[model samples]
Every structure is written in structure tokens, then in C-alpha cells.
Target: MPSESPCSGHADVEGKVGPESSGGPPTTLHSAPQNSPAMAQLLPSDVKMLLLMSRDPGRYSTVTRRLWGHIFDSLVVGSLERMALGVSQLMRPQALGPVIRATAMLYFHLCPRCTVQHYEAALDTFWRPPVKPPTLVFYSYDDPLCDTAHLQELLASWQQAGMPVWAQAWETSRHAAHLRQHPLEYRHALITFLGRLGLVAPTARL
Candidate 1:
């Protein structure tokens, strides 16, 4: 028996897709079974390793930040944020771990029975649709995947082209992986950036 997310212990869980939801988006992350052997065939081993690695605390920094750069729409959006901010919502850190577990259960619940439906559903909806934010994009000047040219392009697009984003380049491969590698530097940059936005100090647990 796999462990459940504290958020996933419900018997009749369903999620509302907006801020006004008396409840959250469906508590379950419905997906195909894990043992289908189908997703294994579909996802290349490297990508599988990367995704699985993200679940492990030690492995979070292996992937380049450019990979996570593209996501912001589907998973983190108005509807979900609204529900997440609801007064009765679960505590962030406490609920997050179990939510992931419960979602794994929702997807792989039929593993021994040889089903692939839920897995495919998750795959289809994996990528976030296009949306921008008052975003701060952080990259290092020397990251191989996100080199000078990419940074230049992004700056031009965001600053000159009126794109809704802000960026800062560190001297390391500190994109998404920065927090894992250099905690202090990451903290300073983030806190300073947020301070600029007048959101100084922890207003609430993010």
C-alpha cells in the first residue's frame, strides 16, 4: 500500500476549476496506470530519469532551468490559485507532499490491472499553456543551455518588446537549480527582487 498525500485522503474528491470553488480542483490527479508499460515506451529514458529525479530532493538540480522556464499557465493559473488561496485550503508544505502522493495514486491506481488511460491523460496535459507573469527570470551568464544569445533574445523580447517579465543573470547555472546549489545567493536575489515589488518579507507562506 503506497502512502497517501494528506490532501488525498478523501473518498469523493472533485476539484473546482476556479477561485470561487467552495472546493479545490479535483483532489485527484487522474491518469493512466504506471505499470502499463506504455508510458515507458513513449517517454525516452533520459526524460523519464529527469522527471523521476525531480521527486527526489537530491536530484532536483540536475536538470537545467530552461526546462522549467516554459511552464506557468496550465498548472499555476487563476483558477487553481484562487482555490489554493481559499481560507480553508490546506497548509502549503504539509499538503504538498501528500498531494503529490495522492495524485500518483490517482494515476497508477490500476497498475496491477494493466491500464494506461490515466497515464496518457497526464501526458497530454503536462505542458503549461502560454501565459506570462510579472516574472523574474534568473539565468547564469555561462549556463550552457541558456547562454548569452538566449538571454539576449529574452531581454530584448521582455524589455524592449514590452513583454511582461523581468530577468537577472547570475554567474552560475542557477536557473531552477540555483536554489538547490547556492541557497544563500538564491535567497538574497529572490528577497531583493520581491522587495522591489513591495512584497518584502514573508506576507504568507508561499
Candidate 2:
């Protein structure tokens, strides 16, 4: 994975389209759902990765993406820790780099239901600039591991109260499995969404 200047807010992860962005494969755009009031009727914009994790145990089995990721992380972390001893130490110095990288990956692999410390910042959060991630599509089921209902309520509040809307979701779908179960509909939905921003070919699948 390629990295970018922290100041840019985007780490160049399979570029989806954005401001001052360059060099990379197309990543999935995280933006307004088809019926989002903001993206649908208000000012529309495409953006980098959407931050929400999708739940639906179905995805763990059907979505090769996450399974492969879990594999890769395990291999990487195991590799690193395996060779890190003292003299002939178990982990090699170079291995440490991969381990460190894997450690940071935690921020992304979180389950759909989560909470964070309430932000009470007055000014500079990151002195450079705040990369406001567009509203994300957080799909979940009644998974005991996450707070699905809470996320739903939060999304509803944002959409109804009408936040500038990172992007509003139109009748939301649940998690990554939505893709596996409804491939065509999922494709159509994503294509339709990104098409509005001119990122995808008009007649192509998303």
C-alpha cells in the first residue's frame, strides 16, 4: 500500500477521486447515498474511502476482501513477531516495519458498532487540516459485537436534521454481504452514486 503526506488527509489508498489527489488505482468512493438530500439535491462531491465498517457475518464468508485482509494481517504480524529476539532475535529489524504498519491497520478493521471519546476540540485538531470524511454508509445487523441500533439512530439524526451531510443515505442497506446477496442491485446503486460525481463510466458497473 502506498502512503501519502499526512498533511494531505489522503494516504493515497486506491484513489477514488478527490482534491489535490494523484497516482493510484480507483478506490471505492465514499459519498452520498442515492437519495441523500445533500448529494441528491444539494452540492454533490466524491471522496476518498468511507470510514464505516460493514457487518453481516455473511461478508466474512462471501467478501474475499476482508478474509484476505485478515489473512494478510495475521501473516504480517506473525512474521514480524516471529523473528524479534535479542542477538539472533526472533524478528528481524526490517520485520519490525511491517509489524508497525499492521498495528496501525487496527483503525480500519473495526466492527460496524463502535464508539469514540467525545470530541471536545475548540480549534486545531491536527494543525494541518481536518480531512472531514464524507458521511459513511454503516451497515450492520443485530450482531452482538456492535451497536447497530445506535449507528442507525445516529445516521437517522444526521440525515433528518440535515447535516451538510458528509452525504445522506437513502434507505440504507446492511453491510458488505449486500453485495454478495444482491450483486446487480449493489452494482447499480454504487454506479449510480458515483456516476452522479462523474467518477465512473456512465454505463459501467460500480
lDDT of 1 by residue, 1-206 (tens): 12223322111221211123333221211111121113232232332322333333233322322222221111111121222232112233645645644544454554522224322332332222122224455555544323356345544654544434545456754323555676675566556555554555644222
> RMSD of each candidate?
17.1, 17.0
| TM-score (C-alpha) between model 1 and the true structure | 0.34
lDDT string, candidate 2, 1-206, tens digits: 33323322334322332222433443443322222111111111222232101112221222212111000000001111221211122224655755544442342134111101101110112111123222334333422112445445544554565422222222444322345555675566555555554566889854
| Candidate 2: residue 123 lDDT (0-100) | 10
lDDT of each: 0.34, 0.29
Best by TM-score: 1
Which residue ranges in model 1 land beyond 4 Å of their true spot? 1-132, 202-206
Per-prediction count of colliding residue pairs? 9, 7
The Cα RMSD in angstroms, rounded to one decimal, for candidate 2 relative to the true structure is 17.0
